[model samples]
Each structure stands twice: as C-alpha cells, then as structure tokens.
Target: MIKKIFLAIIILISLTNSVNASTTSNYAEPVQTISKTYTEGFYKFDNKNDVDIGVTLITNTPTKIMILDENMNVQFISLIPYNTKFYLRNIAPKKIIAIIGDGEVALSFDKI
Candidate 1:
C-alpha cells in the first residue's frame, strides 16, 4: 500500500511538472520593456547646442518679462515678482535672444 501511495505521489508531481513545462515552452515569459519616465513638474530641455550659454536677467526695468527667440522675435512674456526664482516655460535658455525683466537671475543648464 505504501509503495502504491509513493508511486501515485511521484506521478502527480511528474504530471504537474510536465504541464508547467509545456506552458513555459509554448508561451515565452513577458518581456520587460525599458522606457523613459518624466516626473511631475519636470521639464525636458534642448540639448543640441555646443556653446556655453549665459542666461542673465537684468534688473531695474519692469516686473513684466519678455523672452525673445534667436531671431529677436518675441516668444513669451509674463509677470515675475521681484527677486524671485521663476522658470521659463517651453523655452530653452540658450535659444533665447534676450530677457526683458527686473531682477538678477542666472539660468543653469544640464545635459540630458
């Protein structure tokens, strides 16, 4: 009786392993994909320039600021508080022709 029970257990385990082997062989495991993820309030800057960019905001003008493109065309204009840090939306510091504002600011750049 004990020998019969042992044989049945072995058969059950073998059957389970065979079923798992068939499944594993027939369907490959899901491949993990690598992708880029941007966090909230994170911005993607332009990184195709090879020159040192110096973005400086000159004070003693006005609260409203105007950012111009490389061709001197006005792209964006906004009001900024005095002596406060503000971010340029959808504008690359290096691509800007000029900034008309009131406050000293230094823009930093990083390679992506």
Candidate 2:
C-alpha cells in the first residue's frame, strides 16, 4: 500500500510540472518593434499572419490607437495615457493604426 501511494504521488508531481512547462513555453518575446514620432497623422501596421496576434504600445504622450478591418471599419479604439504600457490581445490579422496628437510612440507585436 505504501508503494502504491508513493507511485501516485510521483505521477502527480510529474503531471503538474508538465502543465507548467507547456504554459510557459507558449509565452514569447516580441517578434517586431516599430517606433515613430508624429505631430498629427496616423501610422499603420499590417498583420499578415493567418493567426491572431498581440500588441503592446508605449507612448511618451497621450495617444489614440485603433484597430481597423479590411474595409477600413474600426474594430477597436482606445486613448492611452503618457508613459504607459498598453497591451491588446487576440487582435485579428488586419490593420492597426495609431493616431497621435504630438509625441513619440513605440509599438511591439508578437504572436499569441
């Protein structure tokens, strides 16, 4: 009976470790980075990948960000504050635009 209990505990520990490993493996660093300074206009990013992606935006001044579809319809929009990191997940393969008022912005893209 003691031998059986020990075997069960070992199995449980192995299973737990495997689950943790798989989750950590899915995390990844940024694949692309774009930095730009704008006074008044827009910057576009084309996500050509078939799968959805993730986006992180860091700005030196308050800025507006938008995700647009193929037909130029806005899907998502937000105004991020200055000196902040904003993350957007599950962004479809489409166009992303950043509309700036007057400052610098840095953007990072990665696969989800």
Which one is best on lDDT?
2
How many collisions per candidate?
Answer: 0, 0
Cα displacement (Å) at residue 88, model 2? 1.5
lDDT of 2 by residue, 59-83 (tens): 4665556555544455665665676
Local distance difference test, each candidate? 0.39, 0.49
Candidate 2 least-lDDT 10 residues:
25-34
Q: How many angstroms is residue 34 displaced in model 2 relative to the true structure, after the best TM-score fit?
A: 4.9
Model 1 lDDT tens row, 1-112: 5575457445534643464456553212221222222121112234454333333333544434444444334455454454455554444543432223334545544332
Candidate with best TM-score? 2
